[model samples]
Target chain A: MESVLEVKGLSKKYPSFELKSVGFHVDPGMVMGFVGRNGAGKTTTLKSILNLVHPDAGSVRVFGLDFMENEDVIKQQIGYAVGGVSYYNRKRICDIVAVTKMFYENWDDSEYKHYLNAFKLDENKKLKELSSGMKVKFYLTLALSHHAKLLILDEPTSGLDPVSREEITDIFTKLAQKGVAILFSTHITSDLDRCADSITYIKNGELMFSGNKSEFIRSYTESMGKVPSLEEIMVFIEKEEVVL
Target chain B: MGKLLKKEMKLTASPLSYWFILFSFMTFLPGYPILVGGFFVCLGIFFTYQQAVEYDDITFSALLPIRKKDVVKAKYAFVIIIQMISFVLSALFTVLRMTLLSEAKVYLVNQMMNANLFYLGFLLLVFAVFNTCFMKGFFKTAYRIGKPFIIFCIAGFLLIGVGEMLHHLPGMEALNSTSGTSLIQAFVLLFGIVIYVVQTLISMNSSERNFEKIDL
Candidate 1:
């Protein structure tokens, strides 16, 4: 398959929100930034893609296999991380890893230890005691150490300091270089400019833009008669009405 | 499923099982079976879904590779494990009491007694009722705290009411005797077992369907 992840015509309805015909794709060895404001259905879309949430319509395919039909086989090749690591909070980092590593058939112990050393993570500390940045690193380490070919991350660096954010961005790029497809959903536009090869913007549970990052910018520039960064465009979309 | 059970045991058994084992220190004393069995029954129903969602553990587990139904299945497996623990501890305590302190007659009193088949039946019936009430409310959404609480309270009150009424009845005292197991007692225990197995199957099926229809 050309794309490692493909979501087509996805739909879901909540009492107050809905994702209508939402679709996106990410090719191998590329990063697709899912950009949107808070409550814009970025997380919902990601969750549906990973089957964390059941969708009302459409389908998701990973590695050319139907996601719903081949959940185990498809998920074995995908590693998902939400905004933060939340599980067994009172357990030590190493203990949590020990329990979690058993779930993945291809868990690499040397890779896990290597990442721990590189990130300077203390294995003995309880998860509740770790800094938010360290928690993100721990999650990323788990995702990477499983030999996964795809990473679905929802706001992986949202609450981190600049140094941690930069470090995480570097890791995403490095993983992409190793032929891993990454679909990272974040509202922080600057993170995308640094690492995203393309952008998919969702607003009010709808896709407003999905294309080359430069082309998306140029379209807005031509329409508004001014060049705007992604952050400016997102703010304008939130604060004022604009045509996509 | 083995991996799923392993994860479930790691999450549910460690700390809770430790608490029960500590409680088992008083096992040789009478009422040991009822004590541990009651604790597990209450705890199993209470901890299934509401606690996980409240703690964001549901989100974490959903992000894992396991299917949604596997979560419900693991919980059923956990319940069986709880019952087995109660049984083993009860047997150990019963054997110890009989071997060491039979002359004291402390294990045969009305209020205090060693583990028996009747008590096992009572435990089974309680859990069977519990799963029926709880699985209905839990399958809707893991966050429906009020419904299951009300269900448990009603179940508890009814069982206690039955116990009180039996005390008032004249000939019912014979049912509590610690003599050879009776034919009627065997039938009651068999019925309780049937109910537990059937309710467990229904609970798993209902929960699987309920979870499938939900957004999360």
Candidate 2:
């Protein structure tokens, strides 16, 4: 299968934190779970791919295009959801939609309205006045309406209610059925187990594992004499300093 | 470039900023006649600078399908547009004020011509201000690096004061009546503009470098 996204030797440094060389690839029609603990450089990696944050070293490619050299072209095919729910404070939901529509050529108004109704979001309400869950729904609606081929989400379900989370998971499943490659970063392992085709683990800014989800689960179960949880596996890997 | 400019306009279309720009410009229309033109021009400059920094919108802007050069050009264009509008508004108000006061019409016209020249000078000053404020590491170390800008503005005010004092001298009056540009004056003006443009470009390059270094 052809890869939809690729990262190689990506690294970024700061005074307090450093993201070491991290690498991964997601094939078309695959849902890749990017599992990591808090501050594990998940957001940093997403930011690098989005070109919001530039890496000190290495490269990211989406749809076979260099992210930095072809950012404008790459971004058109990408649908990104930030970790938290934040938008222009004074802007109404409809206003946000209108502005986003201007930038994205493939924006589907009908899809946007459908998601708005599904999430029970008032199109006229200022984003700041909406609840955290509502804001997440709004962002998801915007992301889905863009007709993006690659979905890059950063902890998208962090603060959602179970019902909302299920809705989002279902949406992901529907998108995946259409062969949209997804890179979903989250600490919630249960969501990954339910939807992810493959899993990639990162710790201390380094890739620990990247393989099929079932294979990963089977390996951990055989080794530990129990059906180990993804989180548990992550902890074990970190403790052992496993490089694969 | 058009798309970027459109986005900028949309982002800044809030009623509060619109009124702020209007009120700032109108404040110059009827107040002290001596600085009437400078008042509007300065207000427009402050408005543009404040909006640029306040939105921190440039970070998001950099992600769009636009070149860095276009981004810089659009920002400069936005500032220039605002200044042009403020100039026309101030000029119209000045005309109405003089007509109401029954003042010498020709004198008002000449004063308006000088005001236009001052407007050009103000443009150079604004460019200088933006360069100094946004140049190397300025946004990263905003408050600390901004001290020099405040000092520069003060020095500018003092220099204008000195010019005013010199204007009252006997020889200076004759010098003002001369129409032909002195080579030295032309060189000084040209050099100032070149420096301002160079600094503007450097400031933009520094900002791009800073964006690359930021870890989001």
Task: Give candidate 1 regions above 4 Å deviation.
Answer: A241-244, B12-14, B21-41, B44-51, B91-115
For every prediction, compared with the true complex, DockQ reads 0.58, 0.31
Candidate 2 ranges with C-alpha deviation above 4 Å: A237-244, B13-16, B23-56, B91-116, B123-128, B131-215
Q: lDDT by residue for model 1 over A1-244, one digit each (tens)? A: 4788889999999999999999888999999899998899998999899787889999998998899998877776788877665667767888778778887888899999998998899999987898777887888888888888999898988988888888888888988999989999998988998899899999999999898898888888976779999888887777875699
lDDT of 2 by residue, A1-244 (tens): 5689999988998888888998889988788999888898998888887777778888888888888888777777777776564645566778667666777777888988887888798999987788766776676677778777888888888887887677777778888998889999998887886789999888888887888998888888977889988767876665655598
lDDT of 1: 0.74
Q: How accurate locally is residue B42 in candidate 2, as Cα lDDT from 0 to 100?
A: 42
CAPRI category for model 2: acceptable
> What interface root-mean-square deviation (Å) does model 2 yield?
2.8
Task: Locate the minimum summed-lDDT window of 10 residues in model 1 chain A.
Answer: A82-91
User: Each model's TM-score, in the order given?
Assistant: 0.90, 0.78
